[model samples]
Target chain A: MSNPARAESIAQLERLVAALLAKGVVSEAELAAQQASTDRASPETGARMVARAWLDPEWRAMMLKNGTAAAEAMGVSMAGAPPLGVLEDTAKRHHVIVCTLCSCYPRAVLGYPPHWYKSFSYRSRVVREPRAVMAEWGSPVADDVELRVVDSTADYRWMVLPLRPAGTEGWTEDQLAALVTRDVLVGVALPKLPA
Target chain B: MNPRFSPGSRVLVKNDWPEERGPCHIRTPHYLRGRAGEVERVLGAFRNPEDLAFARPAETRVLYHVMFDQPGIFPADGKQPDKLLVEIFEHWLEAA
Candidate 1:
């Protein structure tokens, strides 16, 4: 499916990488490693964490209270990877996360943020316009809750575990896990009852 | 991109500077975008992530990865776009 346009995209990526290399902003080795990290355990670990948090209230509480500790508790260590952080959003105040300096995300806890998540529009606008962004994700205001935006930085990165949605009250942890969306885990959307 | 730049060039952002804005979608490290380096090399023919990310066919007009010194582009609040990769159109630059 790679036509001239697609070829152009690939070429652009090549030139961009070349530019980066000429500048030594990132080493060829590091860039190659990052480009190859797409298939590692980060996404698996991240998804598993969200799933587990849904099943265990204690673990969920731990994650909300302290992300690194909770991930470690779940056996998801960030030893060789970037640090991990968790931000929680509640009814009184909603939390939206962004890294305005770089895509410094908790790859150990959540996989690469969707390109849109780490965009100028998202980063630049979230803090100034949380309600608008959240609404787009279908996580609207409760009509009484305040909005709060959290900026994750280079030294630290964040992922949010949104408050559990209603509807399968007696459901097991596994059941709840099935309901959590990456957006929900990131507090961008709510996990409502299946439609 | 030049390794250095005249003072009148774009502001040079330090790598260690922290962003003050809340979570941003697009972030360029301050050091790259804010730092006013010379027009080191016009790496011709590439798509800016701003356009590429959005799949904007129109904005994909040849990207020139500009170079910067200690500081390039910096917002008053000290915010940085992703990688300091300013998706500037080539016309934005004026040779010094």
Candidate 2:
């Protein structure tokens, strides 16, 4: 309350809201008029990014080469995307992510990580044995697929750019986004598309 | 169950554990997180902001400063890309 910067932040918000009495900022009615918008990162964009890569080998190469730039080429803005580093899941190995210290995630690209990703159960064990974790999630992969682990720390945050699963011969990107759950991005679920 | 790491040891949190192996997690920031820091001149409770903010003087306990390589944590690959230090109970310590 005394710190100048923090005080300013709160003051500015108070001004924007006009006032805060017993109730807090109520945008329900106002938000409805303005057209409901997503608070979490847009999955539609992520699905498209994946779809484009799947359709174009060149783009796939670019994605592997430089994940951030590759994301931009697909029209997925990285503005405010966490210091995003992507882990590629190869046929021989799968990948999963956990933020043991805290819930540091690519909020801009993939949106908020599910609460479980931050829970001690996941943070503590995801690294100990990823295969078991994925199995619990219902999208277990072959033991052959190597399991790559990632830790999100102060400087970096990570997301899994899973290899495009076989199937969906002609599905649209919008449809694909529906299947791209946060769990998949975190490497818990390997996009269980209809193969 | 295998422990990711043991108490009181200086270790680097795997930046890309998913790309490699071992314990990993995004270090959240406080006064401390991921920095190559020291356990500080050991003694009694560490002073935390919450302790100061909430005025929980009675409940406050001694904590190590637990320095990190970098003074602070950021989003980039190397914003203060030094090392990390975190303070915890005695059991959290392992050989650095």
DockQ list for all candidates: 0.04, 0.07
Which tens-of-lDDT digit does each residue in A51-169 have in candidate 2?
66667788767766666786677565565443445566667756566666666776656765666776778876654555567779997767455555555533345566677667766
lDDT of 1 by residue, A127-179 (tens): 54556677787866664565444445323456766666766767776666667
The TM-score values for the models, in the order shown, are 0.53, 0.53
- Given the true complex, what DockQ would model 2 score? 0.07
RMSD of each: 14.2, 14.2
Native interface contact recovery, model 2: 0.08
The most accurate candidate by lDDT is: 1
